[model samples]
Target: MTANREIDSILQRAADGGRITPEEALLLYTEAPFHALGEAADTVRRRRHPDGIVTYLIDRNINYTNVCVTACKFCAFFRAPKHKEGWSHPMEEILNRCGEAVDLGATQVMLQGGHHPDYGVEYYENLFSSVKQAYPQLAIHSIGPSEILHMAKVSGVSIEDAVLRIKAAGLDSIAGAGAEMLPDRPRKAIAPLKESGARWLEVMAVAHRNGLSSTATMMMGTGETHEERIEHIRMIRDVQDLAVERGYRDDAVETGQEIGGFRAFIPWTYQPENNHLKGRTQATTMEYLRFLAMSRLFFDNVSHLQASWLTTGKDVGQLSLHLGVDDLGSIMLEENVISSAGARHRSNLHELIWMIRTADRIPAQRDTLYKHLAVHYTPEDDPTDERVVSHFSSIAMPGGGAGRKQLPVVGVS
Candidate 1:
């Protein structure tokens, strides 16, 4: 009864918009009933959004190059710099992909890639400049702190200079990739060569200070502890608090213009298929849902929380709406990194709308900045565009044909 009372008090405080400590969050995450936790999280979600709308984005993950120097063990996408299969997409190919995305009503393109040794700040400047010059409509939400650190070192420039040059060269925003686990233990175990978690936050702090807004992400199920999970949230919350304290909130009260800060938090599970870190423990569906609820309840300052349907499958994605997920990540036209790691879940715009509606919420299409572009209230108002389908890539199967398929076991060479 005493434990129950503690849990109830924590739930009440969280649902009422009061802040809960990391210890309270862990208790709710580990001890509270699943339905109760989800209910509290849903209440918090409704309070934050207030409009019964679940949002999604229309975007494509365009990996520029596969050649990488820091080959993390949890990755199945990167190839060594000297590998024969290591190839960088040419400028024309990238532009063609952008054209395809634009034609399909996509307003954002995630230009992620490996950290090539020779690619310096100038390479990214030219790439961003050319992309913006060709398609000014497409938002280049690309790169992460890891890439920035590497590029700065390679180009012999400071981190601030690297961020400023990229932003000036039309790099609209940064993607919070490479933040697998913020804690040092698990992070080093999986990605020893990557920048430390504190360093990652430092880089993001610099970006936020320089007017570059970005999303924050956490890669779970990578052999991390419950305490570590809570610590991750704590770290993010502290940084977010700092961002606000430094006058980097979503809106400038004086000018009414947007400023730099984290716009959303996305938590995805680690895929353990063809990577070097295979045969490790993974997060179950229930654990994922629990974390989802806890994140919603804990991240009071963060505005949006996205559901990773790409990693956790479609059913859980739908259920996440009830567990405090306001956004169902994206209708990814192409995703190679997660797919290469055995994530086979895919969805089209139509299916996503149906999923959201089935969850008893309105469906809305949002842009990179979480601005709604279109809202579907009823079936009569549903979009009729058939081209918005998940068609480009599929999980690697034994035979041919790339239909809606499951992941097949491919041996790591």
Candidate 2:
């Protein structure tokens, strides 16, 4: 058959809820009409989430340390272990930030940082336990597979033991940080000191086997090829398939526990400013959108696809709703890592709800587990909570907490 006919057939199969091969996904990503691809992805989104609600979370990303042993080339956020600026937040300081986040109505705190050489699993265990002891209501969605591997190595424990210890110490879930590119060539190019892509997946698998659910993320625009991008999703899908085969979902259903395996997939572009990679090549906005649509169409087992409005501006983020994204990510009370890498986009509780509403979807505040805690169906019924401001920590701004503005509620463009 001709290329046009083959592409059309693949699009139809994907739109009709049939799984497409990786090659088909790459073809769709490369050749499909932008609008057609988006429409098919939107169909999939609506079919998966019939509620017509776009979900978001109120969370704070607290970087506990800037000291890193693995100085990834693409990251502008880390400091060498012996650098003068390298510092770790004390336990009291971390608890204070958590207190501030809780006061600002954040339901989750994403605790991530560089791989500190001296810090082992015990550091995390104490931190997580203290946070949970003080704020039992707050969800501790912290760390990633890379951190697990690093800590496991530092503490001389197996990955399974490290994950189990932290989970028992009150780590609610893991974040998909450090998954810059899962393909070997691109991953080695960016994060040479980090664990291998296969090892990352292995650690995540161990976490899943131990009943910890986590989200997955991709950092695009780091000079990876189109084929490598598709390969990343394929790797995730293969692992997810194994989780299903192992009765992870069945165990959740039978025991009333939260489902094991990845809960969502979030893909964002790599910010190139102030980083060693230095913007030699980056994924364009169009490229980012295409990848987003392709991810929604391809990751059939993953239930949620979040738009990274924090990296992609609010305008594209608003447009992403129609292009197959069901979640707008988070109204981050504090974000240092991405902002340090020159991600300037910002949003508050009011602005996020308005953005989703203008996209012609109901806005809902979601917990870390993707559970809708509150849904705003109408503008008149929107929450009037003033503490829900954007950049509350203001770590990205100089002198901290200055120049933060109240975002006006505007109509959809």
RMSD to the true structure for each prediction, in A, is 4.0, 2.4
**What is the TM-score of candidate 2?**
0.95
For model 2, residues 1-413, the per-residue Cα lDDT tens digits are 23488877877788778899999999999999898889889989999888899999988888899999999998888999899999998989888888888877889999988899998999999999999999999999999999998898999999999999999999998888878899999999998888888888888889888888888899989889999999999998888787777766523533576568888899998898888999888889999999899898898887889999888889999999998899998888778888888887766688889899988999998888877789898888788887676676667644346234344332334
**Considering only N, C-alpha and C atoms within 3 Å, which residue pairs clash in candidate 1?**
none
Model 1: per-residue Cα lDDT over 208-238, one tens digit each: 8998888899999989999998898788888
Score every model by TM-score. 0.94, 0.95
Candidate lDDT (C-alpha), each: 0.86, 0.86
* Candidate 2 lDDT for residue 265: 90
Off by over 4 Å in 1: 1-3, 251-255, 391-413
Segments in model 2 whose C-alpha atoms lie over 4 Å from true places: 1-3, 250-258, 402-413
